[model samples]
Target: GPKVLQIPSHQIIDMGQMVTLNCDPVSNHLYFYWYKQILGQQMEFLVNFYNGKVMEKSKLFKDQFSVERPDGSYFTLKIQPTALEDSAVYFCASSVAGLSNERLFFGHGTKLSVL
Candidate 1:
């Protein structure tokens, strides 16, 4: 079975600092996605990436957030100048296929806190 792994299950940071969350996606999977959920809100899509380029990004992906795959390694999400509003559970998901109908496997999530 395939799985996605997220590191530093919890992160506490200052409001103006930078944070880079790590995600190890299932091997051989080509599509990766990032999603965020506030304490009581529904999960919102942030961005999707494939073939070394961004496939789609929602408005929720602010200028401070970025995603990348360096040397086919684990997918990563970096947020600079973190804000209090950025506190949320960030999830990393991967799918074998890039189709909308494909099933995604999600990591437990990295809970981020900004103070």
Candidate 2:
């Protein structure tokens, strides 16, 4: 099954720094999503984008976090001034449409280590 692929596999950064994670999804995927998980914790949705706009974002998406696919290519998630609490595995996902029940193909995830 085709799935998303995240770049840099892992990232280590200092607090107050900025990091951008890139996600390469399948060619036909239309909806893009970002999720965050801290080690053993359950994954939480951060945001979803479609039609060149943000369809929804969770409280976890702070002011420092943003997402976009400028060239309709790889979807990207950027976080600036990252906090120590921001250390987590960020997963990128995609699906064909907005159907809630549709299964999303997820990337391996970018493990962010904030120090």
Best by TM-score: 1
Tens digits of per-residue lDDT, candidate 2, 1-115, equal 8968899899999999999999998889899999999999999999999988999999999999999998888899999989999999999999999697989999999999999
The numbered model that scores best in lDDT is 1
Backbone clashes per model, in order?
0, 0
lDDT of 2 at 68: 94
Error of 2 at 61 (Å): 0.5
CA-only RMSD, every prediction = 0.8, 0.9
How much is 28 displaced in model 2, in angstroms? 0.7
Q: lDDT at 4 for candidate 1?
A: 96
Candidate 1 RMSD computed on C-alpha atoms after optimal superposition onto the true structure: 0.8
Q: What local lDDT score does residue 64 receive in model 1, on the 0 to 100 scale?
A: 99
Whole-model Cα lDDT of every candidate shown, in order:
0.95, 0.94
